[model samples]
Target: MRAPGKLVPVVLLVLALVGCTNMPPPPLVTTPPSKPPPTKPAKTSEVVIGVDGITGGYNPHTVADQSAVTTALGALLLPSVFRPAADGTPQMDRTLMRSATVTKYQPYTVTYELRGDASWSDGPPIAAEDFLYLWEQMRRAPGVIDSAGYRLIDNITARDAGKVVEVTFDKPYPGWRSLFNGLLPAHLLKDAPGGWDAALEDGFPATGGPFAVSRLDQERGEIQLERNERYWEQPAALEKVVFRRADQVGVVDALRRGNDQLALLRTDSVGLSLLGTLGNTVAVHTVPRSATATVLLRPVGEDMSDARVRRAISALLDRDALVATGTRGGPGSTLRAEAQVLSPTAPGYRPTRPGGVSSGQPELAQAEAALQQAGYTRGAGIWMRDGRPLSLVIAAPAERESYVSMARELQRQLVNAGIQAKVETPSADQLFTESLASVPTGQRTTGAVHLAVVPRPVGGDPATVLASNFGCLQGESAVAGAQPTNPVGFCDASVQPTIEAALSGAVPVAETLTTIEPVLWREALTVPLFQEADSLAVRPELTGVDVGRAPSGPFDTAVAWRRAPN
Candidate 1:
């Protein structure tokens, strides 16, 4: 495995929280209410979700660690603007948005209205200017951080009071609506010290969510999230949503040992299997996270340096077989075989074939032909570069037993197909460093880091991976902030203009994807992998925890869910 962000992350906050819109405040708590107005009572479920490790840090705009504090903390802050609805979808939550109207296009602008009851946990109105301040702060942020990712937008404009906010992009970027999840406490930070990443550790300001910062325990385990009765929307479900910090591995353990009820995070299956073994009393919801997994493919030995050869190797991959092994737990595992950089469940995914690959049939003839066209000849047992054996290292998820097996099989398969292959196993940290070092090619860097493989992030948004990893991007890209998406080291003379156009907010998602296909096909960076099936194991006793295939993604409506009777 590789380390996280060895190539400098693209503005760290890739996982910022998106706030809810148009929610009617809780029914006024008057004396026994007015003459029996029949109403459904608010839900009350207190199930703790566990994080696997001690959070490295918790600054949304800048913190280095990816703790729950950071992920859940954004609820306290707010995304610059809430998009009301996700990309290419109808607004499902009408109660949350004051109004969903795209006032203008040509200049690429959208505005949202705040409900009159919209107020922070501290009872302050959530002004539209708060978003404006956030935009300005992001534009002017210094040092290296993720907020810069949005700052790269030269044409964004958020004007007006706490009710009206607008943004303008230089050109049409179809995914603009998806980026509406930036958060800011404009009134509090209007004249604060440091940016979001540098907020005072001892004391953070008021937030607009159901929970306020009641106890800031920087040295302890988590930020205890007491439900804010003053929040504008329906009050949060749990009285206390303890944003507990633990290791990813520990998450499963915490849940099974009865230490916690539910958990979310990339975790090992070891601890989870124990729950099943112990059987039913405790419910374990094993949902496949819509997160990306990168497999390492080293370019050492093989002439995979030739884009065609790499593309050819990408073709013969048996994604179904791969998934069978890796996600063998099936419904028991949350891993899915994705079709592109985005998950199969992601929106805008129009699969051309069963899983999007061209004739997944292992074509020995085709592989030979492609290599021949690239100026290479088949030698004794394997393909060669210059009288030397052609081989490269492939890194994968070693935490799973299947990873080791896959690494061995990958080496064997590549060899059988005429390219010599080897496996160079590395820890997660090493994996990141090695993958980054190998992609530029003949940086000879990792010496043998080759095929970094796995299902991509399935957030239904390409930016999930695009905003964070652009490995194929060479030299400077017009898309600033962080660019780790290009793993095949795809370099285009016109990549800058292309990315800019796609992100300009004017193009529709379908149109933008149409534009990116040919370019990606030419680069051979991310060849279409297979569709993934997430494994999930939920004890029947725990009700309301919904996990379904979504037009936008997996596990979408778990928002207002709850655990059944104990």
Candidate 2:
């Protein structure tokens, strides 16, 4: 037994030695330490907002580009000398402006001192050139929101290495704070492809606010904005903000799925119903827009060329009835617009409609009288002027529900008045930039758009609105050899001086409106119907969402928006 066991141990030992020699003794048999569990990627700090649709040409100063998205983008990316208060008064923006004061009375000079650190995102200081660019463009460009305040500027001189701006006006402008708002990047826009006419048609070249546009994907219907780290003021709280385009149903679905944190949509019956489905998860705010639904009778068209005929049409389409029809189930249902110069939501708004004017009941008699005075006779239940029937084309933006609804209502009213009107749905761009714009001096406008149901853009300044909606075209004054075109295609030479007086502070705005509004009403160019409204839906996760003080909707304080802890 000793001899066999000794032999077996000897055999095992030999095999083990052979294995150790080949495999390096089992690599010392040490246990490898475990790595810390993979860290979760830091969640992106972002807020996604659902919007109706994303269209380009984001210049907030132009009537063709007037939109809530344009206003919101302006508030987020552009710099302004003044921002509107809760009461719609222009308040100095301390972040970009140091002091803005009327330094002289003889020449009516306003001096603006900009913060030294204020600069655009692309390394250019926010300077007097920006002011001069806006002034020149507003004064010369057609289809601008308002140019009356800018047209008063006699000269603009720079000081303090372009940080201080000395603007001398031909007359004092009480609404000076409204000027130079949403300042453009002059260095980039001045020599760009389209200059003032086409500037910002795509996206901002440089930003002067708390957020900068990082991406504008039209195909994806998304606009991505990133915090402007170079901003002189406090940076935006969130790292990113996204505007996603969605229809009414898509908006509600996005909110339900927690995909969208906020939404600013045009108010409609269907949209309101859909948003109601979100229930307690979202807070719905009825945000009145800084615009009014108005019916414009363009004189350039043959049917509306006669002042009496225009008056007839204006009287036939009842304002109260249009308001009720256009604003049903919306926030503006109770906000009736009666002033052509200022919306009911605007500061210092006053009813400009002359007293003693009954509702549509009395207006029918007035319409009949005016139509007879214009030599229009009823034939086959349609008004006949010359040998042609008074069959006019009514145009409205297809995208806006209120405008389209109001247009249909207007058509009904005209039809009941023995007038024929055919409704046309065109994109807003075609309607504002082409159809409603004034024709060139030696040219004629080619369209059947006699009546337009459109949004009259209102602002903080009453005088600016007066001139913007009715001012005569000033051709080639700011730039040499440029053609002039009116915004509304209606101008009264007699009232032009009075409008200028209001814009220049020569006449008190309240007094000037009293005089000018009656003239506008008699001209029958525009009839105010109701205040426009927007609906904002916000999720509970959002902390700083508010209907901001600015007319730019709920994104005015977007820089301070934050998400609650998960």
Candidate 3:
């Protein structure tokens, strides 16, 4: 996985609080009117959701402080230029944007026209300055989140006063739509004492969506949002929303006791058998996460660096068995076995078999034959070549229970093929932070891990991820300078051209991916196991519940949720 961006300490504290089972007490819930003497009230409904606590203020641009809770809340209170479709393609939100078009391909340029009626709760119109301010911050700010797309933009200028904005990019970036999904209000943040950090620490200054923050009680682990009457679009169906911090176990308890309406549970934390007990009382929704668990082979060593050896190892392990055991035979158990770096769900994914090598369904006999062809002779139940045992050390993080289980299962499977495999569960910091960096002079030996079980972050475009992991390395950088994601030192110059073409966005995504898929399988750089999916337990009465393709949770479409007719 890629290293996390700089975040505030408070946000980390909140995340830690949410991860542990012993949660803080609920916040003070505002009481309703005792007497019914007021005029007929607007139809009102409230939903209490149990989630991992909201840390890092509500600003989505603050990358370090951003979490699932932060992104979900930002989706409710801010205006997104484009929303992602089910296949991870960006679709323009007609409510906020009148139209968005790419006017030119070279020196890429795009023009956005904002809806005439769109305005902040404080009555400030959404204008070109807002876009300009965000662009400037993303370019100059050190702690801002995901500046890759923004850094490509040369400039953004206002046209026709504040109604339209024209953007020019330094290069042809295909994933431009992924940017500005959570636009911050410039007028409110411009004069903040500590800049964007201090301005957004308390909560949002104003809201453009259907809901606005009514109260934020961090000490009690709660956030309350009420309808935004100033919203320009159709009024929100639900009157109020309450987000309370709870662990996976607490979430199940809250839903069963009728204290909470919905909860998102990690499959690793809550087994499938436990969810089955809920039966028809609650609705379960499986959300696909933009990440995949893979086995990365170190490409530098003489023992395993050879492509034949990697292919043999790939053939020895059963990916379907790993998925089944890791997911505990749940909704995501039957995951599509992947042969290349790109995920099955990613835009440019294509399954290719080079030399008739099967991508899934392990063939132990073929694996043994390949090792024998490589001049390895079996002795004392282990393959040996040039007086060296065919032994491998696989490293995995201790936190993810699923990955640990997969590693153990792989270890057991490899033993049958005369391979001695050792699985090491290291601390997250050691495996992710220290081991990935270049070792210092006179330091202890770098953790020369032969294989690592890790997840790669997948987002709107696979180009960036593909380039970072598989592209050729520029120069000699030892394990000290090595990146954790590419620890195997596998860089193929042959695949660079196709990767560049995909990054340029000039070619059809499907065609580009289809061409690259075979090269990856032929080389056998990494073996992809399965894509990660999240599970949610929602009450049957809540309707219009939709899980977003983006990292945000079900709240992505919170405005559409309504109570079922009794």
Candidate 4:
């Protein structure tokens, strides 16, 4: 009976619990949903720059291929032992070199210690072989740029498993810092199909700088560079860089439309004025280039064989008018050249002309006298010498409007002076390789023209420039290939000793220039008109567009360029 009562209480408890569960759950309780975390905007990492043109031969060491685009590419893709500082002096690149110091006095030894991590984009170590290759090529190559310092190198020794380089000079070279710039990748270029002449003609085989060539199209005039993943230094700020060829109007339009972020162009006064139209959207600056506008009278030509006739032509030239034509009243107009050996804007440049010859005005009376002295008689508005008409052909690069304009002006001036002359516009490559380069020994190729309005490369080592311009090819038995030296085909044996002295560092550069400039001018072979200038125009969204150094301009610090948020 007691068990039955307990079971009844248990059954009642169970029934009460079941009844509570059966009733609807008391008021569903929940917290409000939170808003999703706000997303952030992506940062920009690409930049597009406008350039005048894109010629595929990108070797910075060659006279024929030396241009703004070449310099820019070299700064982005090549490595150098020393780079130019803002003061225009050699400063060792800390990213590539740990230390570079003079170790010996007697043999004049210089020891360079490369950073252990420094390497080419393709994973090859930047070692002594690269230095050796550049030295061998520069000292021996016919058309290389500024090989004087390389020639002084007697031998190179490698140590520390190729991480250390020891250079032994035959004599003390104070300008040794100028050597080994834009070091090429020996592993790829040494045995390439075309050798030094054809090396980098298409694009770099390997890159040693912060950026590498991702795309290079010659016909389309576009070269795209991307951040080099193998670079050991700080990564470049921009992920992609594109060099696009465009004219002045196109560049202005692109900048306005945000298609281009920056532009480096060979500009005239009208070009500057057009840039001014952009107002606060862009900033423009004048960047002095390493070349000077010049007029060269090829003595190998029949009409210009006599120095007197050359002098007569020189006397008739209106340099001011030519400068105005070439510069188009731009900043270069203020850089009128006053010397044969150095550009007026170059450091230590001094006028070498006699006092009376300081003014660059047409001396019509002197021109007539010189023509008469040369036994040239005027007949039917043309000079005739030895029963031959004194006619000439003036040449200029077709791509360069300034050069073509200057050539046309010169032709008009010569025609007005009773000297029959015609203008010829040719491609820069053809003009440099065939018309300007020295022909091989025992073989002759008559150039298309006798007079050339060209850009003479300067602002390098004075000795190297002198040798490149006027010195005879010493020790070389024959001109086996195209030699971009002595373009006028005129050399004086008497000045050979002085040139050697300068190249050997025996005579100071200033003294050497002083001694030889007058002789060069008296020869009447070449006349420097003005220093050339390139303008860098930058859009507001693009930052870090500055003249990094004296020679290379903005490309020297291209790794620091960036695109800012609008």
Query: Per-model C-alpha lDDT, please?
Result: 0.49, 0.80, 0.70, 0.82
TM-score of 1: 0.61
lDDT per residue, candidate 4, 109-160, as tens digits?
9999999999999999999999999999988665566665677789999999
lDDT by residue (tens digit), candidate 3, 1-566? 64456456768888877888677767989988798677853233887888766654566664334445666788788898987776677889888999988888776899899999999989999888889888988654543444546766888988776889989987787877877777778888888787854657778878888898899888888899999998989888999888898776677778777677777655552545566677887787776655677777655456666777877888887877777667776555545645465666666565554655655578777888888888898998899999988888887777566778888888887887789999999854356534433222222233466677776555545665554456433222233343222444554545555655665576665676678777777667677777766677788777888877755657678889886532
TM-score of 3: 0.69
Could you give me the TM-score of model 2 versus the true structure?
0.85
lDDT: which candidate is best?
Answer: 4
Sort by lDDT, best first. 4, 2, 3, 1
Candidate 1 overall lDDT versus native:
0.49
Q: What are the models' TM-scores?
A: 0.61, 0.85, 0.69, 0.84
**Pairs that collide, model 2:** none
lDDT of 1 by residue, 70-108 (tens): 544553434224322444343423333566455776765
Instruction: Tell me how far the alpha carbon of residue 308 in candidate 3 is from the true structure, in angstroms, after superposition.
Output: 2.5
lDDT of 3: 0.70
Q: Candidate 4: misplaced stretches above 4 Å?
A: 1-43, 105-108, 301-303, 356-360, 424-426, 439-445, 474-484
